[model samples]
Target: MSQTPNRSYADIRKALLAGEETALLDVREEAPFAEAHPLFAANIPLSKLELEVYARIPRRDTRVTVYDAGEGLAERAAHKLRDLGYVDVALLEGGLEGWRAAGGELFKDVNVPSKAFGELVESERHTPSLAAEEVKALLDAKADVVVLDARRFDEYQTMSIPTGVSVPGAELVLRVAEIAPNPATRVIVNCAGRTRSIIGTQSLVNAGIPNPVAALRNGTIGWTLAGQQLDHGQARRFSEVSEVTRRQAAEAARAVADKAGVGRASLAQLGAWQAETARTTYLFDVRTPEEYEAGHLPGARSVPGGQLVQETDHVASVRGARLVLADDDGVRANMSASWLAQMGWEVHVLDDVPASTFTQAGPWQAPLPALPATEEITPQTLADWLQEGDARVLDFTASANHVKRHIPGAWWALRGQLAEALARVPAASRYVLTCGSSLLARFAVAEVKATTGRDVYLLAGGTAAWVAAGLPVEEGEQHLASPRIDRYRRPYEGTDNPREAMQGYLDWEFGLVEQLGRDSTHGFFVI
Candidate 1:
């Protein structure tokens, strides 16, 4: 991961504030970087840096700071840079993890395109927004006003205003008819904080969605500070809390638990879940494919939890199915479960992990492991079950690297489109998930569980693990090339798909990409 010598956080933060042309480089996995990052940090994963070193960080002399989850991964990355001849390379004193300790900010919401959209919203108003009291007065007088929560349904469930309905940011374009169905329904977008709502509301204005739209000034934080009452759902509590705001969100979480009311399943209930295998019973690892291959449950999918939830529909079609989730990091399970609760499923976290009926395959994965040994599920079993219940199969074997190879009958569902793609699955079915290695198969398990809440299983290792274990390996991302936005979120993900997602994806894509090009801050390392 080495790039060059070094720099300091204060120096870089100042340069950023002063609008200096410093390149804020984050050298972590795309998934982790996407979770939270600096406003201007462009991701250039440590893995791919060796190959695309110059093209990515064109300016050899630009100041660069690298960081990891505090494992000193950055130091190694720095060394890599020095060998490559890039000067002015320094590790983030603590990386993103360190920034938090120093009280530096961490941002959420994946689409950087949304940030541009927010600017458009701010410009539309041109003037400061009405005060809370002013809006309250209008409500008392029954003036026309509509508040829209712009986050995903999963996010909306956690916490929202009493009367607001879920209208995700991407929906402003596709579901405009639903939001302002009558033409007079005023729309206002809001999230826990400002950016998402600001961008979401503006996307409609930019797309000409034909409705009076505005943003909830300052988002949920503003509402609560105004002494207004917020609504809590069975599983979600509306507040501005995160790993970044855990202490603050605690009260809200409890209120949400109280309002919607959730209870842990008893041992009997847990046993019942183990018995329901009519559909695919997927056990996903939710880590990188490399991590998955290192060691995971014998049979599980390998969709990383973040990617799984983000691309739910593409993984499975079942709406009311059963899903079980697992993650080495409990935070992933906790954060992921919050979303699963909203999608509606019989969800379990398997807190005891290996102690339960399911056991982990073994220890950590190497970059890629050869297949293991196991007899195949007879075609008779697959064919017989295909009739009674439901099932669909996908092969992530392409690895998002350079289409290395694929499973014989695997289909390619790009991580981003997996959600909309999988919406077509039947609720009462099951499916076998495969990838080049067993690691990704387990991750696919997490995706299936989070999205469709259906049953699923993994090939003992992977297609490779299976073949090494004596299964099979096909070749490609999918059977058909229907044109997709397959660009890896990071350099290590390697190159392939379009910089932007597929057309008509979630409604707000095209315009956002266009604006992103226009805003010349630091270019997106992953787009």
Candidate 2:
């Protein structure tokens, strides 16, 4: 009767929290990890470690700790570590959830959109702007001005000023020279939301682009709300993907990839791990802790790829030890494996492999679940609203892109602040929930439905897709709250805590211009 070792969570916490040198092993699958995870854990599956412990860990004297979703997994893993002669091995009490709830850095995706937006805000001083009427008036009066739409070509195609040229947010910094040719051009940048527009104009102004760069006031929203006609079909005001197309795409991707594990070892290699009596088994689940908890492999650890990539050495200190990766899905595995492979270790991404236990366990929970819309809505219908100008709509983007510039009366609100924002919003009018992509926006609509339960629809494809359509975007400066910003800072400045405050702090402190897809609750949008 070999039982797993008993370890105290407090001891593991003491070491990690105090920044002491210790090995933190995570054993969880992938897809769930994609949602969120510990900032300093590595992935190594028990089955994989059973074969490659000596070759991988190669150290019998290191202080190694194993964790999973409680349920006696970590203890079993610890005992195996001992049998393999790992001099000092312990189990994380309460497994993944305990570590995260105790202020550990839990990670989500790479914090991309938010950072992209931050780049925009930092480049210029709010790029304060004026309305379309004002800009048109200036043009009519022969004012010397050039307009820049910091959106994609598709966005431009959807709706854009005849004179405005498309320049995606990332491209603005390098391409501003092309769009705002002369210093006297008076450059103005706009996107459906304020981030891109602010970033674009600010980039030029900050870099001292000789011309005057300003955001269009109220962006396209102002243009339409001002009783102006939106160029439809030929030029839409924003992006709209047909529901049929999106659903088809989703259906096409129906469970082809394992989403969590990759680079599986052959039977021989697995057998080697099991026989490696002189090594420690470090199982790392790159998925988020919550995902690990809902039910992961019997002894899989959790790392949540982002953290694993950033803090590899810290988690798997054995420079050459075995690292088994499990993601909630392949996305995290693929993304993390690319980085780990470059670090000179024998790293394998184990995915497309199925565990019989997982299939039999029923539905696994999502680490971060978005609120769903009570009523189903179509993109064309939402597009109709933008073209008609019959109603003023707010993006109500989550932190992913938080509300930027809106038509004259449109507004922006934090996902956590939805209740208050909605309370302030008129109940009689319909509202639009938006995020980077429609994933979170759809959830936002769901939250609204569950709470205010008002007439709300998600922005088709979110604003990024909107910009892709070559839609008219009103440029303006909208400020985001970030610890890096001179005016704001986080308490401890961390990325591991699953706490709401920490999420917001990390969203800013970690250079995420657009992090956490607008909503703070379980609500989120997949980019």
Tens-place lDDT per residue, model 1, 334-357, is 334433443333455545455344
Report the C-alpha lDDT of model 2 over 73-102, residue by residue, as the tens digit.
Answer: 466567767766777886665577876666
CA lDDT of every candidate = 0.50, 0.50
RMSD to the true structure for each prediction, in A, is 24.0, 19.5
| Location of the lowest summed lDDT over 10 successive residues in candidate 2 | 518-527
Question: 265, model 1: CA deviation in Å?
Answer: 50
Top TM-score hit: 1
lDDT, residue 6, candidate 2: 43
> So what's the TM-score on candidate 2?
0.31
Which portions of model 2 show Cα errors greater than 4 Å? 1-308, 311-322, 325-380, 386-410, 423-428, 468-470, 477-527
